[model samples]
Target: MKALIRSSAAVSAFILALSSSGVLIAQAATTGTTTTPTPMTSTATSDLTAGPLTLTAVPSFDFGTATLTGTTGDKVPGSSVTGALKVTNPGQIGGWQVTVAGTPFTDTSGTALTGTILSLDGLATNPITADDSTNTSTLPTFVTPETISTSATVVESAAPSTSTSHIGIGSYTTSYDAAASSLAVPSSTVAGTYTSTLTWTMSNAPA
Candidate 1:
């Protein structure tokens, strides 16, 4: 009876130890941890650009009316007229120039008036507040009254702005004066009005 009881006690102790070892192994297998990596990012950029250059003219030049009291082959002078012209440059890096040309004055009959002369002078620019290095020392000068020719004449010119990065706006005001002389008064001088047209051109090229 004592030997059987000792055998039963030893078997029970071995079973309990095996059960505890199994439980510990199972808990250890489930105790591990895990983790994942995160992502990262960024961007790039630039500046806005400028637009094209532009030019405009206003107020047609009018020499006004004239009365011819002189005799045949005589020359008569007419009153002078004044007007303004504007130039706008947005993104131009270089300089600019302006020119003008006109057709001959003619009567309603399309008869080209002989000895007709037109003169342009007194060129002035506005916003003289800033100094431009490229400007001419003297403004354009047209002393002699020139007859209407096919070729155009340069009236004004300005260089690239040294003070500002870009030329914003520039204005030119000029005086127009004219004179008419009778080369040979016909036996019958027509009685009517005379008219002519003047065209102005602006160029990116400097004068």
Candidate 2:
């Protein structure tokens, strides 16, 4: 009877395997490939033109109104803006100078003022930077208490360039000091509005 039971159990296992569909299969996983980075480049530029050495700006002087003092010479101190003479250098030059002169002060009816003096007092020298910069070197000498001339007079001057440092290679400005400007009028001066033109001349002359 025990042999008969064991045979029945083996037949049942065989029938279960036969009733199934198909076999289960397992597939392996995989990875992908990669590459390194790359590099690139570009460019840029600018341009400059040569500028001429020249006097750029001239200042205007205004001496305030005064009463006629027919007894003696009259001195009037005046206040002014743009009281500096500005110059620019184009480089490749030795040095330079500035000369000053004035025309006769004339009234509306063409009457002229003779023996009138325009005194530009002590002017402070300025050192240049950038195109013309200041350094530990000898600077230009400026005429002080300058009694303006009918003819041209050297108001400011500089020595010739002995080397690169000596060359006048930048912009320059000589400014007026405090209460440094005045107009001197002779006795019996006309009591009317008068206008005068101050001629400022700049040159490449190295003195």
Candidate 3:
């Protein structure tokens, strides 16, 4: 009887061990799960630009005065001195204006000389004609023709040429168009080295 009891006790212990293992396996299965997220990369690009450029004349002019020889009182018919007006455009793209600083005037005499440029009041003693040449009607016919009666020439300019403008009446006016690279001087100018400072303003236009 004692031996039988011992065998039965061993069998019961084995069954209990199996039941514990089954419970552990069920718990593991219920909690078993995995999750993963996707990975990615992004990129972008852009382009920028600017507008056209602009250029203009500066405000400063540097046409030095002339040293007058003959007297303004001793007016002659055809006696006249010569002078030049220095014009220029400061910008990459050229521009236009009526004269070397907007108008022409004899820095020495300060006379209203550029009246006849046609664009002005048309009262200029001299007016510019064709071929950059000067003429009378545009130039004043002095009482003393020998003392003061002369004409001027419009010195042509290349891309950007150092040109001269003639003015006999006193102060003359001119116009400029940068695009055209052209300048205008009075038709009736004197024969001296007249000068007017021309300043330019730069442009932003494409080269």
TM per candidate: 0.50, 0.66, 0.21
Residue 202 CA error for candidate 2 (Å)?
Answer: 0.6
lDDT of 2 by residue, 1-207 (tens): 999899999898787766542222112222334777887777786565536767877777777777877767798777664646777665434678888899999999999999888887554444222333444345566777688868988877776767546545566666665367888889979799988888999887876
Q: Tally clashing residue pairs in candidate 3.
A: 68
Q: Which model, 2 or 3, shows the larger lDDT? A: 2
Candidates' C-alpha lDDT: 0.52, 0.71, 0.32
- Candidate number with greatest TM-score: 2
lDDT of 1 by residue, 11-34 (tens): 999999999999999998889677
Worst 10 residues of 2 by lDDT: 21-30
The residue ranges of model 2 lying beyond 4 angstroms of the native Cα positions read: 1-51, 122-138
Per-residue lDDT of 160-193 in model 3, one digit per residue for the tens?
A: 2122422221222232222222123344545454
Superposed on all Cα atoms, model 1 deviates from the true structure by an RMSD in Å of 11.9
Give per-residue lDDT, candidate 1, residue 138: 33
Displacement of the residue 108 alpha carbon in candidate 2, Å = 1.5
- Pitting candidate 1 against candidate 2, the one with the higher TM-score is 2
